[model samples]
Target: MPESTPFHDLAAFIALPRVSSLALSPDGTRLVTAVQELSSDRTRFIGALWEVDPSGERPARRLTRSGRGESAPGFLPDGTLLFLSSRPAADPGEGADDKQEAALWSLPAEGGEASQLLVRAGGIDGYATATAAARIALAAGLLPGAADAEQDERLREARRKAKVSAILHESVPVRYWDHDLGPAVPHVFGVPDAGAEPSVMVDCGARRIGGSGHIAVSPDGSLIAYTAALGTLPDEIRDAVVVVDAATGKQLRVLEAPDAEFGAAAFTPDSRHLVCVRERRITWDSPGDVTLWLADATDDQDPGRDLLPAFEQWPGAPVVSPVPGEDGTPVVWFTADEGGHAPVFRLSTGSGDIVRLTTSGAYSDVVASPDGATLYALRSAVDSPPAPVRLDAAASGQEPVTLPSPGQPAALPGSLTEVHTTAEDGTALRAWLVLPQDARPDTPAPLLLWVHGGPQTSWNAWHWRWSPWVAAAAGYAVLLPDPALSTGYGQHMHERGWAHWGGASYQDVLALTDAALRRDDLDGERTAMMGGSYGGYMANWIATHTDRFKAIVTHASLWNMYSFAQVTDFPAYWMRRQGDPLENTERYERESPHLRAANITTPMLVIHGDKDYRVPIGEGLALWNDLARFEVPAKFLYFPDEGHWITKPNNIRLWYATVLGFLAHHVLGEQWQRPDLV
Candidate 1:
C-alpha cells in the first residue's frame, strides 16, 4: 500500500509551507509572493516575501526574513519591493521598543538588506502604490481628535502609560470580527515624496469600523479611491467609494447609491476611469446581488454604469491592463466563481465584452503584464493548494502554467472526482469527492460529509482551514457540496435559501450526500458530517433533524438564531436576512437548532473560538450546555485566542488532531487516543 501523505500527520501538515498573495512589478519582470511557514518554535506561522520567476524557469528565492516576518508585497515604480513588517527598525529612534507595530519596509531592486521606509504609532494597516509615479498611499489609524501623526502618537503614548485599553464607540458597531473598532479610526495618508511625512488624505472618522478601509491608488499617482460607510442612520449604513485628489488630500467625489454598496476600486492604466465592485444591499423580500461597474475616476455623478449587467457570476477585484488591448480599448482582468471553479476573465471597458481566460481553478491577485500580453495570478482548486501561475491575457479558456513555487504539497493519498444530484425542487446540486486510494467496491471508505460556510459561498477554492484531503489521507471519502445560496449559480441560487437556511439548503446537502454515497468507493453505512460557521449551523440542523451520520463536528456555529442575530458583529446584516426577532419570531423559532437539541442522538464534536465576533462564543457555550442538558454524547473544543478561524500553528495542529481522533472513534469504530497536550 502507498504510504500516507502529509495530511495524515498533524505535525507534518502544519509544517508545510503555504503561499498566498501575488505581486507583479511595474515592469512585469519580477513576480513576488508571500509564503508562510511554521516558525522556529512551531507556535506560529511566519510570513516572508519570495520572488518567483515570471518566465517560470528559475526557482523561487526568498527576499526577506525576520522573526516578526513580512507580508503584503507591492513593487514601487523604481522596482523596489515594499512590504509590511513589525521587525525592529535598522536605525531605531527614541521610544522604539522591542514590540513594534507593522511598518512599511522596502528592499532595493539591486537586492540587499531591507530598510524601514515609514512607521506610525498605530502602525500601517495596508497600502497601495501608484503605477506610473513614486506616490504611496497608506491606511493607518488616527485616534479621535488627533489631527496628525504627532498627536496620534502622543495619544497612543498616553493611553499606554495609563494602561487604558478601552475603546469608546459612538456608532452602531463597537467590535468587528475579532477586535474592537476604536478609540482610533482608519485614515488614508499620502506620501508624495520618498522622505516626506504622510499627510492625512481622508479621515474616515466614526463611519469606519473593523481594521482599515480598502484603498486604491490611481496609476498616474493623481487620485486615491477608498471604501467607507456613509449615512448617519444605522439601518441605512452603506459603503461608498470615496475618490480623493492624491496631491491635495481633497475629496473629489463619492460614488454611492441608495440601495447599493460599492468598494474595491481599480483605476484604469490611463487614470481616467475606475472599475469597482457594486453589491445591491439585501432586503426583506429579495437577496443581494454583486457585479462590476465602470466609473469616471474624476467626476461621474450617478453610480457609474454596470459593466456586468448580463453576467451572472460576481467578479472579484479588478486588475486593469497596464497597457491597452491591441484594439486600443482598455481591458480589465478579474476572477469570478463559475460552476465549480473561479476562472480569470477579460473585460473590455469600451465594448462591454467579457470572456473567460481560464477554464478551471480559483484565481486571485491577478495582475497583467506591462505589455498586456500575459497575466500572473495565484490559482488553487479543491484538489490543489495555491501556486503561482502564468496565463495568456487574451486567451479564452486556456490552462495556466504553474510557476516555480515553494507551496507544493506532497502527492495526495487519494484521487478527486465529482458528485452531482438534483434537489427535491429540481435544482441541480454539485460536490467534490475526495476518495482514498485504498477504497474498493468490497472495501469502501467511510464517508465524511463536509458542508461549506458562507451559505453564500461556493466550495470551489482551496481552504487550508477545512481541507478535505486531510480526511482522505485518513482512509475516508470527503464530500464537499455547494448547496443553496452558493454563489456562481446566479441570483436564483441565493433566492432559494434566503431566510430559509434550514429548508432547501439542508435538503440540497442531503441530496448531494445521498448521491456521493451511491458510489462503490464510499460507505454509506458509516458516515459523519462536519462544518464551520454556516456549515456549522447546518451541522446543528442535521443533528436535530436526523441521525444518519455516526458523528458530527460543528465549529464556530450558530445555535440560537434569535440570539445570534443580536450578538453577531454585524447585526444589521443578519437582521436584514432573518428579520427582527421581536417583530417576526416565526422564522427564528422554526430555524433555531438549540430549540431542537433534544433530538440529537449522534455523537458530536463541538468546536468554537471565543474571539469570533461573527458568531460569538455564546452560541458555542449554549450549544454545549444544551448537549449536556439533554445528556448527548459530545465533546467541546474551545480556543480562547482564535477568532472565526484557528490561525496559530499549534492551535491548528491540536484542532486537527482532536477532530481526526473523534472521527476515528465514531466513524471507524476505533478506540480514541487523546491528542498530546490536550
Candidate 2:
C-alpha cells in the first residue's frame, strides 16, 4: 500500500529516492545511475548504484548497496562498472578498515561480487574513463611533501595518531564554500588498466583546483586534460585547462588567457581537439560571460576557437560525441540555460553549427550512446525532481522519453504555470507560479514570493533545497521569478542588474510579483517573501524597500555589504563585482540593505547556518540584532552544524516546519505553533 501522507507530507517527500548522475556503457548496452535514499537510521541519505536499461524496456535494478553506499558510476572500455565507495572490502585482507576513505571499486561484467580496485590516503575525489581504451584518470589529494601514495598514507596516519586537525594555508583563499582547503592538494593519476598501478599525471601542487573537478582522458588513452588553478595572488587566481602526457606526467600545454578562465575540458574521439568552457573574469565595469571553446590538443600556441561566440546564454561543459556527425566532423553535445529551460544542444565542431536537441526541462549528467544516435541525461523541472531520460542526439526541438527512475515523486499538490510582465524599464520579466489544487477566485491561496539564490542563476530547474511545491501543499501560491542577473535569458538580462543589485533586479522581481498577484487564485493581502544567499539578500532588500510582504524569511543572507565583502569564503570573486569597499562605495552605500533596516516594518524570520562561509553567519546575526534594535516582530532560526545549505535530513525537516509555521502565523493568521523539535 502507498504511504498515507503522500508526497504532500514533508516526511514522505523527504524519504523519496533521488537519482543524480548517469553513466553509459562504451557499447551503449547499459546505463547506470546513482540513487540516494533515506538510510535505515533515517538520519542521512545514502547513495547506491542502480542500473537502468538503455532500451527502457526493463525496470531499473539495484547494482550495489551498502551502509556507506557508492556513487560516481562509470564504465571501463571492457564494460566493467567502476564506482567510488567507502564500503568495506569483502575480503578481510583487502585493506578495508574503519579509517578507510572513499576508494575505487569495480564490478566485473561477467557478474560477481565487486572488489576494491584502488585506494588512496585522501580518497579518490572523482575519476574519468576513456571511451576507446582501458585507461582511467583519477583525482586524489596528497599531503604536503608526500612523494608517493605510501608516504601520503603514512603522513595521514601520523596526523591521526597525533590527533592534529589543522590546515596551513599560504594562498588567498583558505576556505571554500563550506569546507577548508588545505593539508592535501589534489593531483591527477592515470591507470593503464584496472590491474595497473596508478601513476601521477598532473601534480596540482600548491595551486588548488578551484572549479569543478573536471578530468577527461583521451580516447586513445595517451593524454589527460584537467582544470588546474593558476597564479598565486587572490585576484589573479584563475582556472586553466592543462593537458599532459598520461604516461610520463609531462605537461604538454596550458590553455590560459589574461582575461578569461578555462576549464571543463572534454577530448574529442580523435584526441586531436578539446572542448572547454571559457569564463571571462568579472570586472567592476562589466559582468562575466561564458562560451563553448574548442582548443587544439596538438598545438600549444593555438588559442581555442569560440563555438558560441554570439550565443547569449551560457553553455555548460561540453560532452564530445562518441561518434562524429553525418558529415564526418566532430560533434559536441552540451546543455545551456535558454528561456527558463536547460536544453541539450548539438554542436558541429567543423561547421560551427549548433541545434537545440531537447524542447523542455533542465538536463544534467548527459552522456551519449557509442553510436551517437541517442543521448541520456537526468532531467528535472520546477514541478518534478530529477529523473533519467533519453533524447535523440541529432534531433531538433525533440521531447525526451522518461526512463524508469527511482527518484520520481508522487502527484504534486498543485500545478505550475508561468507569470509574465514587463519591468519599469520595458524589460521582460517572467516568473513561475504554483497554484494549490483547491485555490479558486472565492478562496484564493496566500502568495509566497520565493527568490532564487545565485544572482547569476535562473529559476529553470528543480531545486531540492527550495521546493515551491511544499508551500503549495499548504494552500499557498509560490512565485519563482527569473529577475535580472538570472541566466537562461540573454546576457543583457544579467548586465541589466550588474553591480546595481537594488536597481533592475529588484524592480524586475516586484514586477513579476505584481503580475502574479493579479491572478484570481492568489491572495495579495496575505503574502510573504523568502530567499537564501542572493535570494536572502533580496528578501532583506525587499523588506527595507517595501512593506508589501506580511512576513519575510531570509537565510544565509548578506545584511552588511561592507562586512560581507571582506569575510566571505571567496572574497576576490565578489570583490570583482562590488569592487573594493574602501575605494568604491557607490553600490555599497546605495544598495546595502542594512543601511535601510529601520525602514523594515514587515515581520521577519532570520535563518542562517553557522558553517555558511559564503554569506557568513555574521550577516544573519547582525540582521537579527538590527531587527531587535528596531523592535520589529522577528525570529531567528539558527543551525549550528549546517552550512549555506541545510543538508542534514532532520534539520531540513525542522527548517521547513519552522518556515511554514512562521508564514502561517503571519500570513494565514494562524496561531504561532513552534515546531516541537525546535
Candidate 3:
C-alpha cells in the first residue's frame, strides 16, 4: 500500500508531482521543476526544488531538502537552481548501500540553502569534460570519485571491480530508496559553474556523459552544446553531441551517432539543433522505442547533422521549445500516443504541420511558461494525479490548469481501464489491461503476456510501475503490448527492426502470445514471459523460439551475440548496434537465441545485476550455463548489489517475489520454491 499506483508502461507523464526535469527560466517569468517522489525505490526518491505559480495563488515551491539522489536541473547565472546530487549526511541507517553517485548541487530561486558544488572523488582532479556557458562552468577532472579507495586491498580490488562479467554475474540490486547510500557511477561532470568553483572542460572519456542531461548553452550564449558518452569501447557507445569553447575549455566539435543512439536528450532552440533520442533498441523490455535526431554543427568543426527529416515518435519523454506559436513558429512538440489517448503534438518545423494539441485519455506533457506564452499541457493518468492544463498557442483552445499533486495519491483507485488490441499485422497494438482488484472479468484470469524493453522503448499514457500494483494484488491479468518496435505508433512502426532482428519482431511477440490465449479470462495453460534488457533479449529469445511460455524470466540478457560481440562493457556498442558481427553472419546466427542454446525447454528464471555494465551479467550467466547444461528447467536470481533495472525496494521485493513464484508456478499449478518461481 505504498499508496497504491502501479501500471507503469512509461509514456511518461508521472504524477505525485513527478515532472522529471524541466527548464526555460531565462526570463520567461518562472517555471522550474525537477520535483520528485517516485514513491517507491529508484531508491526512495525525494527531490523538490519546484517553483511554478508566480502569484497565481501558490502551486509549486519546495526548493530543496532531498537528503539524496536528484539530477541535472541546472538554471544558474542568477535565476539560480542547478542540480545533480547523491549527497546526504547527518542521519544514516535507511542507508542500505550500493556506493551511490550524483553530487554537484545548488539552490535559490528566491528560496535558500543548498551548495556543495562538485566532489567527483575529491582531488587528483581527473574528471575531463564539463559545460554550461555564459556564467561559465567547465570540468575535466582526474580526482572526483576517482578509483582506488585507500587500499583495503584497494577496497577489495575496488569491490572486484563491481564484477558482472566474470563469467556470468548478477550484482547491481542494492537498496535504501534514497537518503544517500553511496558510489554508483555513470560517471558524470559538466562543470562551467555547476553553481560555481569549477574549471576544466571536455573529456567524458572521449564521449559519454549525457544521460538525463549535461550542459548545452548556445542560443546566443556562445556555442556550448554539452552532452556526452563518448565512444571507443567494447563497441562504441559514443554518447556524444559535444561542441564546447564556452570560454576556451576547447574541444570544439565531436558529434558521432550514426543511425540513432542517445535514447533521451534535448538542446534545440538555436543551440544549432541537437535533439537526440536516436536510441536503437535498448531493453528491460523497451525504451529502444525512441527516435528524434537533429544533432548539428556549422562551425565547431562539423560532424553531427541528422535533423530528423522523418521518423521520431516516442522520442523518449521529449519536451522542447513548446511555447512559441504566433507566426514566429518554434513549436516542435511531442508527447506521444497520437491516438490511444496521451496527446500533445505540435511539430511544425517551419510547416511540417503535425498539430493535434491535446486529446485526453489522460497523460500529457507539453510544458512552457517561462514567458513563451503559457503551455503547461500535463495530464498524467492511471488514476489521475498531474492535472495542470493551461495551453495558448496564441489562443485557440485550452484551459484546465488544476495543478496540486505534488506527488499526489492520498488514495487512488478506478481509472486504468483502456486496453486496445490488434497485431497479426493489423498494427493498432497498445494494451493497458490492469485488472485483478480481486479478479473476475468473468474469471478466466491468470495471464501475463507483458513484454516491453526498447523493443524500441514505447509505452505512453502514464502507467508508472509499482510492480503492477503488486501484480494487481497478486491475482494478475496484465497484458501490456505496444508491439511493432513500439513508440506511440508512428515513424514506420519504429523501424520495424530496420535490418531485421527476428523477423517482424518475432512475429509481433508470437502474435501477442496468441492474443492472450483468446482472452476469455485468460489462463492458456498458464502462460508466462518476461523482459529486461531488450525485454531480456525477448525473454531469452522466447525460450529459444517457442514452447509457448509456461514460464521464462530473463533480465539484462543478450545470451551471447557471439559472446555479446566479445565480452560486453559495451562491446563497441553491440558491434555498432547489431551489425557487422562479421557482416551479419546469417543474421547473427539465426537471431542469437544465445546461438540457439539447444532450444530451451522453458521453466526458466535468470534475473541479473552483478553491476550490469549494461546488460552484462555475462548475459545472465549465458542463460544459466545453457539451462543447467541442458537439463532445461532453470533458475538463477543473482544481484550482489545491482545495476540495470532492479532499483532496490528490497531488490524490488526480490524482483516481484521471484515473479510471484514464477507466475505462481506456471499459471497457477502453484507449489513453487523455485520450480521456476511458480
**For each candidate, what is the lDDT?**
0.87, 0.87, 0.55
TM-score between candidate 2 and the true structure: 0.97
Q: Report model 1's TM-score to 2 decimal places.
A: 0.98
Better of 1 and 3 by lDDT: 1
Clashing residue pairs in all predictions, respectively, total 0, 0, 102
Tens-digit lDDT track of model 1 for 435-457: 88898998899999999998788
RMSD of each: 1.6, 1.9, 23.7
Predict model 3's lDDT versus the native. 0.55
- Which is better, 2 or 3, measured by lDDT? 2
Write down the RMSD of candidate 2 (Cα, Å): 1.9
What is the per-residue lDDT of model 2 for residues 1-678, given as tens digits with 9 covering 90 to 100? 222334468887788888899999888988999999999888999999999997888999999989899999999989999999988777644344674588999999877899999877788888998888887888888898888888888998899889999988777677778877878988888777778764433343233767886899999988888888888888898898888887767788889987899999999889988999999999997889999898898689899788988888999988998888778878999989888889999998778888988888899999998888899999999887899999888889898888986877678888899999998778888888888888899988899999999899888888777988888888889999999999999999989999699889999989898898888888889999999999999999999999989999999999999999999988988888888897889888998999998999999999999999888999999999999999999999999999999998899888999999999999999999989788
What's model 1's overall lDDT?
Answer: 0.87
Determine the C-alpha RMSD for candidate 3 after optimal superposition of all C-alphas: 23.7
